[model samples]
Target: MSDRIMLFLLGFFTLTLTILSISASEDAVKPNSNDPVSFLCHEGEFFIKTRRNHSEANRGRPGEWKTACENEVLELDCGEDKTVRIIDVEYGRSDGTTCHRYPHFFMSCSSSEAYHKVHQRCDNKERCTIVANTDEFGDPCPGIIKYLKVKHRCEPVEPDTLKQVVICENDSKTLKCPKGTYLMIAEAFYGRADKSTCPHPKIKDTNCSAKNVMDIVGAKCDQKEQCELTASNSWFRNPCKGTHKYLMVDYQCIVDDLGYAAACENGNMEIVCKNSSVINVVRAEYGRGHPFVCNNSPTPIKPKGCSSPNEIAIVYGRCQGKSRCVIPATNEVFGDPCKGTAKYLELDYFCGEIWDPEDSPGAPIIKDVTKSTVTFTSEKLNKTTSSEYKTQMKGADEKDWSDVLDGKAFDLGKELSIGGLDPNDQLDIRVVKKKEDLSSCIPFARFRTKS
Candidate 1:
């Protein structure tokens, strides 16, 4: 064996070991949403065990209670196929709480009634996250240092297709599909699209919000048969109360041998932007992945609401028909929908119906450009400082304007190229003199970047 070959082999093994070590470290830090959590539970379960103070004793007055700091939130989530079922609950200076108090509470440990409020929000769900503070759950026995200790277990369940539910306030209907099957499509009608169920309302002008219900069904009900959809504010928010209304759902289920879907496949996101000035979202399906249907539990994406890295509707909505559009898919833009889901914004858009600025009478004309302040700041500098960077139009007659990006390229039908000469560059872009205004401004800036 040659000395060179031996050295090469040693280096290769060293690189392999380093890579494995880094991978192992990442696995430890990145807690998998799908991984079962074992916290203060026996098995297939988790405990709330929340309190302002870690002690079991209660203190404080009835309406005059204060937390040590900001109230803490504890979230217990079950994986994709299971839901957290409260086995038992002993609340209000009591023992455990896995289920009910009947959704009514007075905030006083004067009785065991307040605990019911906690049960209503968490029972039989894939995930339950409640703030461990009197302010959130209400100061049940206000002044006392009370605790919300719940014992819950996850159970395997799926949406059923054999459901026939009548419409009413806060009523939910679940449709269960058989095991090893996926819901291909779901057709739901609330008031009656065909004027079948209580179409003419015996009484006069009763506002049956049929259109709104249909829109909701498209967002939450389609491709799902197992979700427990209710007539409460969560879904339709009561389409019509006074008028007669009932829900009707018809769906088709397919076998799961075909791993990912083709038409409505995994990592599929679609957004239909109307030609109207207002981006009329005709359809927006963020998650079309199987097993990971509407808001799947134990997500691997950050800021929850997302199921996969195929989200495109959000980005599409931002710059669908614009000549120039820049969008950043960050927490600030779409807020955290789910805590830990490997989510991405992917929208399937064809290059059809292009918006040509040269053809439209209302072509974009950004005029009257003056001052531009780019706030830049970071650590070491305890404050934010705005730059004196500004730009002005030199020739309005020639449609002379300027655009300074933090280095971003447009993603439209064609590459939007902007570069030329007004006098030299047609636009003057630079930073003016600094101000001695002695304010809370720092000398640093950071633009949005991908994760």
Candidate 2:
């Protein structure tokens, strides 16, 4: 009976060890073998097939959970047959805490290929939707939505000091700031604002001419608030009257009583004729002479007058009837007596010799005869004593030799009038007696006939 009890005890001990081993295996499997929360999928839904019965409790430590799920809880080699779908997305739990079970949609997927394939299909088809929970339907997946809030994109904001802002109203249209305002911010978006905001001021109506016009010395002005017209500004008036005449003296133009005439320089004077009248006078001829009155007849003649360097002379002479007139020799012939014959004869005859015959010869006779004939000859008075002298005769009829007859032989004197006899038909001759002096025994003669 004791042997039988020992064998039974061994069997009991074996059973106990087997029960412990089974319990341990059950503990390991049971901790991880809860069916993963069922994730439903539809056509084109992005999802991942959970490893069968994977549980959060099977995750070892915070970091060891990955190793625990290798090939079993976490699928490293997923076949095409096992599939899952992402029919919902839970961003936050009901208590407003971050959902730690699946921090992101990617944590629910085992394979990146499955996740990317599902996402691509859903993005193309626009059929995928996300549910916050099993009971609440959530927003569609951003990839599948036609219009999406693009992540990380922000609306532009402008500073408060910006005077103008622009906004895009549609795809092509944009709003702009008003006139008189500059763009400080340029084109940008304001949160929820539809139009552009601009800074503007109220413009007061004022005259531009009031600020432009100034005071000038000779300017003519008119009464007006705004001066835009051409006639409204300062202008120059017509200062001249009548038919205006201009005389250019220098560069300036001056107005005068005779209209517009220029001022004159040094000796120049401008004479403006008024009323169509004229002053005419002949100009005097220029020369150095006494001007005589011109004769008024058809043949004009100039009067006898002396010119610059000469004096006029006048004389009177007596005339006989077509015959030569002779005046008797008297004291009256010597220029009315008191002036004397010598002075009168000196003035008239200029030291010339004159004749006054005492009587007329029966034939041609010499008058005023100082000497009549001169004989020239050479002779030898003695063999050794030769001398020379000239002899003179009183008249042709008288043969009286002069004082030189000392038995000295005579020499001939030269005939002075070899050219022609004077109009008196007698010769007035001078004879030289010696080589030292001319002789005073010279003949002076004249002839007259009574018709």
Candidate 3:
């Protein structure tokens, strides 16, 4: 009986020692400084840990050994238990065949209970997956929890080539060649290279020069009689004549009787003069002699035919038939008729009648005359003059006069009659006495007859 009791006590003691040894071994494997275990927390998963060195004495305790491993397990804790927790997850080393990392991270939770409750809520959902773990669930430990930030990252992107370009007016920006200097390649450009060149000079040519050009304007000429050329300088007016000659003179070439070799000078030309025997010379002055005669004289004088005073005479041949004549009828001439002439002649005739001379001795029976005591009136007379009529005869032997009836007494027989007049009528007879002296002869005479 004593042996059996001692054996049972010994067996109980061995079992209790084996259980304590197993608990201690599990506690030794809890996360500590010497053994670091890494785990991942997804986006929106709360990260939580017991405080560092939390309950340091409880680490190897009888029931605390299992709690350490339980808390150290990788889980999504969303901080529902009032425990301090990381609200964001930071990326650490990833798991599986394909894994990636994120550059930035953010916090998502603030307390322990809220952290653990969030993990419990995402327990069976496809929202998250455990990436890595240091232990199983329900372990107690303070360990590092790494996570992958599932949020997208926005970065600046670059392009392959440059953008659209445009050319502006008056833009003088030069293009830099790959091997050459900055030069004005063209007037304008659009996309890249110089597609259009300047309108003036081309691309690879030099610039234009700065010089001036000259032009000449010819003068207008008027007449065909050789124009005189004048100019400012010798370059234009040298030897001015003919086709290209410049120095011109006043002389002109003409074909006259003098034969055509610079015939006229001093700006005057006899342009229309013909080359004939009678040369037509253009006189320079006004009153120079001309070939044709021109009469420029006054009239002449003449005289009357029958009178003379201080009168001008009409010389016998000087008067034309229609020429005017003048006569002096008065002491003063009325009109000086350009001639001193009697324009007409005056004459008188007389007859006396005789009867028987014995019957009427002293007186004749009748006496008549065609004209007696005539008065001549003209422009030559101051007033007038008269003439007498008589009938008488002169004897040759004695210085006496005889009656014209006595010499021819033998004609009438019974009654003697000299003129045809009646004897019964009383007639007065007048005899014209004639003297033998020639000086005493009557200037004029008239005749009378008895009845």
Best by TM-score: 1
Superior candidate under lDDT, 1 versus 2: 1
Enumerate clash totals for all models, in the order shown.
53, 5, 69
- What tens digits encode model 2's per-residue C-alpha lDDT throughout 1-451? 9867855765565466557435433322111111111111111221222111112222232211111111111112111221122221112122211222222211111211222222211211111222122111121122111111101111222233222222211112222334322111111121121112221232122111111111110011111111111211122122222111111000001111111111111111122222332211101111111111111123322322211100000000111011121222223331222221111010000011122122211111222222222222222122233243232222111122223333343223212212221121211111123332332123222121111
TM match of model 2 to true structure: 0.11
**TM-score against native, each model:** 0.23, 0.11, 0.11
lDDT of 2: 0.20
**lDDT score for residue 65 of model 1:** 20
Candidate-wise lDDT, in order:
0.34, 0.20, 0.21
Per-residue lDDT of candidate 3, residues 303-410 (tens digit): 211222111111111111112222222223222322422121110101111111211111121222221211111121111110121233221111333344432221
Give me the displacement of residue 154 in model 1, in angstroms. 41
What are the per-model C-alpha RMSD values against the true structure? 22.9, 76.5, 85.1
Backbone-clash count (model 2)? 5
- Regions of candidate 1 where Cα sits further than 4 Å from its true position: 1-166, 192-207, 212-215, 221-225, 237-241, 256-451
